[model samples]
Target chain A: MALWRVPLDAEQIDVTLGIVHIIKERCKGCGYCIEFCPKEVLEFSKEFNQKGYHPPRVKKPDDCVNCHYCEIICPEFAIYSIEAEQEQANP
Target chain B: MTIAQEAIREATSHPLDDLLRTERIPHIWCPGCGIGTAFSSCLIAMKESGIDLEKTVMVSGIGCSGRGAGYVKLDSYHTTHGRAIPFATGMKLANTDLNVVVFSGDGDLFAIGGNHFIHAARRNVDITVVCVNNFNYGMTGGQAAATTPHLAKTTTTPLGNPESPFNLPLLAYAAGASYVARWTTLHARDLTTAIQEALANPGFSFVEVLAPCPINYGRRNKEKPLDTLRLFQDKSIIKNNAHPTELDVDWEKGVVLGTFVNNPRPCSTDMYDKTCRLEEKPEKKTAA
Candidate 1:
């Protein structure tokens, strides 16, 4: 069991954050990520990525529990979850 | 399954019947899938456990094995794939009194959920996990799962699986699963006992059920449900891990069958709560 800990705190006002992105190229379409997420945040995209596998696109970013079920179940090392970037409105 | 059958013994309190969610019947599984047999076995264990119904929380991830949590009528949650243990951990920590359990499949537990499996075992969380191994993943057209034997024929591996399969129980034992045992559905009587023991044990308890997927793996191997079970009875040579020489047998064609290991450790929560104490609740003042 590989445990990856994101040793950071949540920052407010994150816009278009790159929290988690699918690698599409290596995905085997196992659907483990869609099946295991505590939050129904991921869905199989209608469009197939360059890899020819239907990768999961984040449908609801706020719902993620970050429990890491997706990162663990991905046999192909396709999905990587990271902290969302902080977005600030210009004063 | 087994636990639910225990309900029959009373015939009066109807207490066991109360423990089952009647609405969830007519479960979706292929005929002759050992999951059903294993399910009944689980039911009997819960019935005999004498534990309070409300306190037992069955948390499960996806796949056929995930259905094990739903069969029981308790504070149950059919959680997402490979997430049952963490959900179970949360449930246990939130209450600390409930008997948290994870009923899941090999693909859910060892493949995608493998990391959580080890951490849960290492933490020695106060929970019981029963992983049903049917070799291949039967739910998805019999694809080769992590539990499938190397070179076994599966849908994805039409030629045969080139990857090595897991020694599920050994992995658990290594990661500090305090109470660990492996039993084939053929050893239903033995399995019932292991479940009983796991329910009672303090720390993380794991039991691997070597069950059959007749429609999937069995079809290729040309075996019926009982035939697969009979193999466990006739050929399995594993007894005590240290005393293999006592039994004479060919190693390849046979799988080990029994309640192999049973060790108890201090509950993980007990240790965690000892140092990191949460602040006490403040008293609310009554309106003057």
Candidate 2:
């Protein structure tokens, strides 16, 4: 349950730090992750994966507010958010 | 920090991964299909139900949606076409302790499996049936199914379906389902809650999930996946206790969606045990 909610406010408050993990192999090029993204941070890549599906890429990584709608809507489970920080920031 | 960021920062693990058979991923469903959304909602429901995962079993009939059983990391059976209900019934009656769930597509459940459906609901079998209604035979190249709307063009109905379709919710309600509801993939939260309620229910429970079959049903019907979802958003009216008969699905008239019925009744097992007496077996005392 906790994982389901991506906490949009948390991402909005901090603008400098955001990362995303895109497992290109797992992607089926549904474009759902790009289409349903509320933050408009994703776009279909010009390059195709091994499976010939155009996996999504983070076009505006800074604009990502961690809404997780992309993750939720992605049927392939290929794209996900990854929050990163410098050492000694939150550790 | 955002939860996603925090997770990456902390290097924590996800809780839901164990629920899925990751090795079998890159699922066969086409891009923009709604079956994945519906399946994910059902997974959320099962996780939230707090039931014993080990004792739970998933049974699926042959169809694109039937692949749900194979994808879930649980005790599952991918049975022959249109027999998921009977297989699940046998499992439930034999153990009486297992939680059996039947997940399949409209073609498998209502067309080839329609007879089993009525009998199961009539007897009030204790099982949760999730029917993903894509309005056609999605896996087999989108043929007109029992639930396909009139005037829709399918592979088999290229001239447009002259016959009317079955009203799933009305049928289930009339057949004596204890909990019956209809929701689209767009209504994930509501659908999840409805599925949880259905799983908790004691008697025959039915949930009809209206999904988009973009490649087959949509391409021919002149609708994109997102367009179908938007239609659901714009036209869907939530009438929680609406009469089943009045809830016919006609996009022109707006679609009625909600938990149409939620009445608990004694399940078949209870009635059978009460009516028939069984001789008590002696306890084994060998090598004591």
Candidate 3:
């Protein structure tokens, strides 16, 4: 991603990376996380869970900024995100 | 496996698992119902408030939202219908140190329990009341409730609701509540912050949470759950400190959402101790 107006200290800044986690069985497929995620990182999965609902899948995993919007917005508490480790960020 | 897939595989528990009754993995609320969102926000606020969890108690009345008490891992009371406030008031009076929070639905809080709400606020009880207004009695087959919007369709009001809904914030302010606010389930961040403020306020506090009742209220109103959330996102005007009278639940005209009141007053316990306690008089005499 290229910044339209790069800051003087751009090299010093490290954009946080996050990994999305989905608990399939707990999801009721409300689509709240998908609809409200700022990064547009999630999409409905093709496979259904035990309850016969399609849980969300991380489509653009690297795009996530660890906002936790999906976690707070999920009524079912099915999705969350945690910050990526240093090795994972480079890898 | 990709990083996201690896994370999902390694996920053992949610951060909120410690605060919730995890055994009840899936709650009873239906798909697209907003109660769970509001409930989760309340829990998040409780966690963020930095209060002593051991001294806090959650009280709830009978309704769909009333089930909140059962899900929280705390000293919670699932009180009788419309009696959550009174029960909470009793607990507050008995142990002034406890942080009492009443979580109930529009039907439970305003319909049968309406009087209790006003009286508690009027007396300035030191408690936080979270009322989830879904515009109808969702659990009871979507019956018309005290907070149901005017002319809306419900199970009982099939043709259209004839009466107008109560402006909850205005009612709370009028009843002498010290802190009052309104927010929708879609505005989870603001709702959580407002609940935190309500919990910290020294006197009676009331926060009204507007949630979608898709299965019952929406089916008849021609609104899908997503549509209702979109409406909340687009139509809500967040004017902090807006007058209470302007905070009505009108979708077409737009809903006013914010903290309307935050002035502290002497709470009921403090006033009672000041005026009625006999032991305090001896201390005053000795000082003189």
Candidate 4:
């Protein structure tokens, strides 16, 4: 790696995996992901959770990285990272 | 072609059909991986460009997103971790006739390759870039990437991220990208159109597709593919006579998504192309 030699034609990643997960049921419609992700990935949704709180929704799935931070920090363990890609790769 | 028709075209290409790069099949990407979408968009852009496929080359770095060059059958240079841009640049400067495109990731671009991203945008090279922005590093397990959300959990950050993220479009626009547009994979047709426009537009055209990485980073955020798709449909704001602050605008159901930037004063590569003192730069002088 050149340490720093990105070309003009580099792919512009619009969606990516991030570090946080939001528990829809316990989200309380807090715009944390929207306010947090540097890439502007998360957004608030109209749908409410079991507690009648509108949870934060991921607007970009293709960009997520399953960091599991969203689950750990949430007061509620609503958001948790799963090994979706691992299954596809092995199976 | 319309998306439905495009699907037909997609079906026509039998598995392991035409040879462009290497004979790589069933690309080893995750199900619901945005990298696949980014790769497909690149093909759409190249097809729209009408550039000779034999004369075109694709480059990539390391990461789940870096596999583009190998997946699509084309003249691809699967380079090092984050040097895809430089590799593609070398290819272009050496042989301008060859359409050089780089497929990279947020971690590759924003983290390790950040400096390259700025310089390349400033140089205004003649190439079309399609970047997928998923907040974290998807390939090497989940980690806190440059684009990770603040106060979020990551493999590294057990508690939560205490930092902020980058505004990519603003960064690209400020860096002097000749053509810069933003869209999400949810808007597949519009995304294809943006890719087409970026490829056709001369100078450094950057199209950032907000894609989904349902497997790696998404699961951490509790986002399944269907839920993520619905989120895209809800959160996107269509491009029109929208307000500047409209970028920060929120919607009730889905987002108002559409083309944001199309044309602006282009920072021409004509000056550099002429200064290089070479015509069509000749392919691979000595072959690496």
Candidate 5:
């Protein structure tokens, strides 16, 4: 497929973004998320999912811009992003 | 402990999860089939259109593409073969508030459902149609259909298809579709944009999506899944508002893709209501 990074302008980027959740079994191993990630933050894991497909793994989590291109291009809807929880200050 | 492990901790959540029939996941479509992409584009369009999901209904006829109705978590109907248009038309006329969309294949739309296609456009039915054209009957083992290109090899045309394929954009434009466009599965953004526009249009709007049937159509023609996509990327030229007559798909040369028609016209419902009002007023005075 033609993998193009869809730029989302006018959207706030969550600087404290933690992780992109990947539903292992649901990933069809299309690699669309990895190919379309503008940050080059993802790679295919050596371990296979239940379907024997290699789901994407976060290679550089801190580089993520919180863009939803990976989530949108996932034909199986297996991947999504979430912001990290704030660290509690000392009492 | 690891980033991969952390990411896989929870099932990925998406806004479209509720919009899909998840139980039908790992859908029946073969790997690399373009229907999923086309269907996703439609869902994105519907979501972006800001239409009331509760008041929208998707109607589809029998084909590989027809399976879309079953997958979309909407008031969708997998109607009889080649009847998606008429079924959606009835839904629209029964409740004008509902946004009726007909999603089906080229064989279902232009072969058996062809008469309905012409009549629906001629009547200016208020509906959006997404026709996924894979060039052959994928469901029925790749038989040659009305849209199969001339000299293409299909199961039904073992030597070569001697018949000329219908120029779909021209056909739809000539048939009186108010908004007409064609896109490939490779052009997801363009397809989604056109679909969004078609959904918002007032009268009959048709969007033809050229998709890949990698298993049935591709293997027979020596095109693997990615190779099929390469064809689309290499051969497509976008020309918005180009005349339909110039938008023919020639595999050797290239295919022109664009939103060819977007002129608004009075829909059937609007005309019917106006005619009824005129006759009702005249008949009341005569009776009095």
Candidate 6:
């Protein structure tokens, strides 16, 4: 919904919801996912993983569109997204 | 387990786990190195190419990128430095049905294995070569490599590299590659697509991937990993089917990326079977 002008049929189209998952232990804290994410949904967390590098956290979880850009861009296979359940999408 | 813990466990299990060596979780790549992205793209392409995984092989040469063979859950070969292509060629010839993919670094391919690369391409070998060009000898303390750009700083070339870099796409095209393409690590989606296309090509296919050597090449050049990624985003232009001659790595003038050549030629195996095997079969039949 980060559009300049809402589409006329926006309400009719069911937007696919996504749940961003971050595996803190595997992350190297490269920040590629944070930088390239189209939705700007992730941000660096203050807490560090075992490697002492800060991993990303979902800032606006609802904004994720299941594009999987973060998953593909993540140098570490530490993050991924699965489509949210129907109940979570409605909620 | 609590629901939250169960969810966390499920989330941590990646889709690529089946394709990767699970025991090798947490690869040795640096925080900002681009090889991981390139390697993952290759894995995705291999999965999506719909090829027979049982008969597929991954080969690597000695380098940071060469560690790829160790991480994959496939029949892989970790060959000697600069010999990945030759080994892959042998595999393809011996087992024509096997899908051979040579994944190695620019230094390993173009520096020590340059002759093998040209010869393989010239013969139109039925194999796919993915070269990750990080612009320096990363595993060897950031030394200047054959793909190091002019005036780039490296441990060996502190004052800046004096020699020009090779235009890999042009080299592959001139050597008779049936398909050639170039993509930076930032273009992960396109890179995967190109790899898939290269996988499907019948003859020699070369894909040159531009990756960031933040620890090695970038440290001397004063470009951080993020800065290099930003440059890749702002400076690269997509020109599909562009002449191979125009495909050079010029960061200042913008980098050209896309599939440059894709015309099929009779591959080496087919030619050999047609000329050599055809004659031998007739002689064997007459003797019988």
lDDT of 6 at B156: 85
- Model 2, range A1-91, lDDT digits (tens) per residue? 1232466686556454446667777777877667667677789889887888888877776776555456556666666564445323654
Candidate 6: which docking quality band?
medium
Ranked by DockQ from best down, the candidates are 6, 3, 5, 2, 4, 1
lDDT per prediction?
0.69, 0.83, 0.89, 0.62, 0.84, 0.89
Q: In model 5, what is chain B's TM-score? A: 0.94
Q: Which should have the higher TM-score, number 1 or number 4?
A: 1
Q: Once superposed on the true structure, which residue ranges of model 4 sit more than 4 Å away at CA? A: A1-91, B1-23, B240-257, B264-269, B273-288
DockQ top scorer = 6
Give the per-residue lDDT digits (tens) of candidate 1, residues B144-172: 98877877889899998898788877788
Q: Could you tell which candidate, 1 or 6, scores higher by lDDT?
A: 6
TM-score of each: 0.66, 0.85, 0.92, 0.65, 0.86, 0.92
lDDT agreement of model 5 with the native: 0.84
| Cα lDDT over the full model 3 | 0.89
Off by over 4 Å in 5: A1-20, A31-43, A58-70, A80-91, B1-5, B8-10, B279-288
Collision count of model 3: 0
User: What is the lDDT for A47 in model 3?
Assistant: 91
For B1-288, candidate 2 gives per-residue lDDT tens digits of 356643442222223467888877878999889888888878878999998989898999999999999999999999999999998998888777788999999999998999999889999999999999999999889899998999999999999999899999999999989999999887777898999999999999999999989999999999998888878877899899899997887999999999998999999988977766465633322331
Give candidate 2's TM-score. Answer: 0.85
Residue-level lDDT tens digits of model 3 in B155-224 = 8998999999999999999999999999999889999999999999999999999999999999999999
The C-alpha stretches of model 3 lying farther than 4 A from their native spots are A1-14, A86-91, B1-10, B278-288
**Residue B77 in model 5: lDDT:** 99
lDDT of 6 by residue, B141-189 (tens): 8999999999999888889999999999999999999999999998899
Better of 2 and 5 by lDDT: 5
Interface RMSD of 6: 1.8
